[model samples]
Target: MTRKEEVFERVEKSILDFDGDKAVEVAKEAINSGVEPVEVIERGVRKALETVGKKYETGELFIIHLAAAGEAANRAINEVLKPEIEKKGEEIHFTGKVLIGTVAGDIHEIGKTIVSAMLLASGFEVTDLGKDVPIETFVREVKEQNPDILGMSALLSTTIPVQKDVIEALQKEGLRDKVKVMVGGAPVTQEWAEEIGADAYGVDAVDAMKKARKLVGA
Candidate 1:
């Protein structure tokens, strides 16, 4: 097999084995061997996560297994992939710009943070607005940053309506169609996403990254 393919196999194995150190080691090796950082992430890390997702769906793996893989993938992407991408001179550009935050009255951030890291690893420029962000804040940032996607998270059922509020604010400001909106969290559903006029709903971080890529045509 080619060197890149060999390294990719190692990466895939490391992640499946939940070996963060090995994943990082092989990822660095892949970069040192002149593999593109995005290539390593997309072909190696993402493929592993896709398997993890399938395992979760099939009841072959628990939440802990998925979290372990996600953590290992994040570490490899940050310590190995991102650094290499930055070393590529000035020719590199982000896959897209994404603004993410937890909606108003929601003090939860774990899900949002995970989604942000996944997007960043996937080569998207991300701006995290943190938790308890007001609807006006979301609207203002959308107008200011002009990001390709705006992702909102709400862990509480009560705060879920804040997503609709933000969307309405966007429409009132004439910016609803300017950016794609993605909504999710523990309580979010595909029905709610469609009801609120969101462009997409991600069930997890990996799904969010995939949807973000599609939104940007990457």
Candidate 2:
């Protein structure tokens, strides 16, 4: 196999092993060996996460381990991608910008973090508003940033309603149609997103990135 493929395999293994630092090292090796940033993410890291998720589904890997794999893969890509992102900046320009947040009354952030990483990998600049974000924060950020997409994540059933509230707030400000909106999390579904007037609903981070790209025409 090629050196780039070898580095990718190593990074994939490191993520499955939950070794964030080592995964980053392996990604750097891939970069030094001439792999593209997008390639590292769409190929190496995702391949690792797919395996992790399959193992999780089979009960061979626990939730904690699955979370760790996501974290590790993200960390590795973050390191391996910085230079290429900069290079791409000078070439294609960024396709879109994003503002991401976890809704109010919910403190979960891991999933949102993963989505943010995936968006970054796809060349969308993201501003993370973090956990327990209120509608006001979403509105304010959208006003200030005028991003192409706004992504809301709610892991709790209780907080899922807040995602709609944010959309309503956007409409009230005459900004709802100015930006594309997306919703996701454990309790979120495509039907819910459609009912709430969101542009898309993603079941996972990878899907989120794809939908975001489409929403922004990027």
Candidate 3:
């Protein structure tokens, strides 16, 4: 295999092995080997996570596996590849800026984390707010960051209401029309998303990336 292809293989394998350190190490090696940072992210990290997503969907992998793989890929991208891209004065050509979080009272982050990694791999500049994010924090972030898309994940039916609350809060702050809102989780449905006035609904990470791209005309 060519040197670039070999580096891509190691990067993908590092994520599959769920080794963040190895991912970073491979990322630096890729740069030193003259592999473009964006190519490493798209061809290496993205491909690895796509496989991880499929395995998780097929029940061959558990949530822990998905989380570990996603986190490892994200760490390498954020900590290594991104800095390299910056150093080379290369604009990432991101699809858009996305702010994502798991709504309050829901500590479940596996779904959100996977979606965040997928979005990042798909060329979206993602800002993850982590789990149990308050409605006010979402609103505050929307106003402050002014991202193109805001994605919320809630794993529990009880916390699903928090998604609506956040939307309403955004409306109250006069920020609802400024950004497209996407919602997803185990219990979130198309009907629920519409009822809550979300701009889009994602059934999974891949679907989320598609919908997000469409949301921004990317």
Candidate 4:
């Protein structure tokens, strides 16, 4: 394999092994060897997470494995590549800008964390508003950030209505047409997404990446 290809392989392996330090080492090596940070994310980290997502879907990998892989990928990006890009004053060619959060009353964050990592690897600039985010916070962020997409997660059945409430808030503020809305979580369904006027319903992190790409025409 070519040198960059070899580095990409090692990066992918480091993530699959859930070795954040190794992933960071490989990321530094990639930067030193003249690989663009975005290229590492797209060809290396993203490819690895795609496999992990498939394994999870087939029941070969569980939630813990997913979380581990996500953590490793995030460390490689946040710890290594990000700083390098900022140092070089390089403009990251992001696929799109996404604002994501877990709805109010739901402290569940595992799913949102995974999706954020996957989205970052997929080349989207993601701003994670974190768990238990209030409806007004969602609306205000959309207004301020003007992101290409707004994603909401609600793991609990009772908290699911908060997703709809946020969408309604966006409409009330007349910002509904400014950005696409995506909703997901354990209790979220396609029917629910449609009923709430969501632009897309993500079944999983992989699906979320795909739908986000389509939503932004990336």
Candidate 3 lDDT over 45-138, as tens digits, reads 8888779878876889876787688788878989999898888898665679999999999999988988887776556788999999999999
Per-prediction count of colliding residue pairs?
0, 0, 0, 0
For residues 1-218, write the lDDT of model 2, one tens digit per residue. 98777777887788878898998888877777777777776667777777776675588976577656766765765565756766777332455888999999999988998788667545566778999998999999999989989999999988899999999999999999899999999989999999999999989986887899888887
Q: How are the candidates ranked when ordered by TM-score, highest leading?
A: 3, 4, 1, 2
Task: Provide TM-scores for the models.
Answer: 0.64, 0.62, 0.75, 0.74
**lDDT per residue as tens, model 4, 1-218:** 89989999999999999999999999999998899987898889888978987887798987778778878887998899878888889755678999999999999988998888778656677889999999999999999989999999998999999998998999999999999999999989999999989999999988998999999887
**lDDT (0 to 1) per candidate:** 0.86, 0.81, 0.90, 0.89
Ranking by lDDT: 3, 4, 1, 2
User: Relative to the unseen true structure, what is the C-alpha lDDT of residue 88 in candidate 4, on a scale of 0 to 100?
Assistant: 81
Off by over 4 Å in 4: 1-6, 32-34, 50-63, 93-96, 111-125, 155-158, 172-174, 186-191, 203-210
Q: In candidate 1, where is summed lDDT lowest over 10 consecutive residues? A: 85-94
The model with the greater lDDT, 1 or 4, is 4
Better model by TM-score, 1 or 4?
Answer: 4
Candidate 1 runs further than 4 Å off? 86-99, 109-130, 134-148, 168-174, 185-196, 200-218
Better of 2 and 4 by TM-score: 4
In model 2, pairs of residues that clash are: none
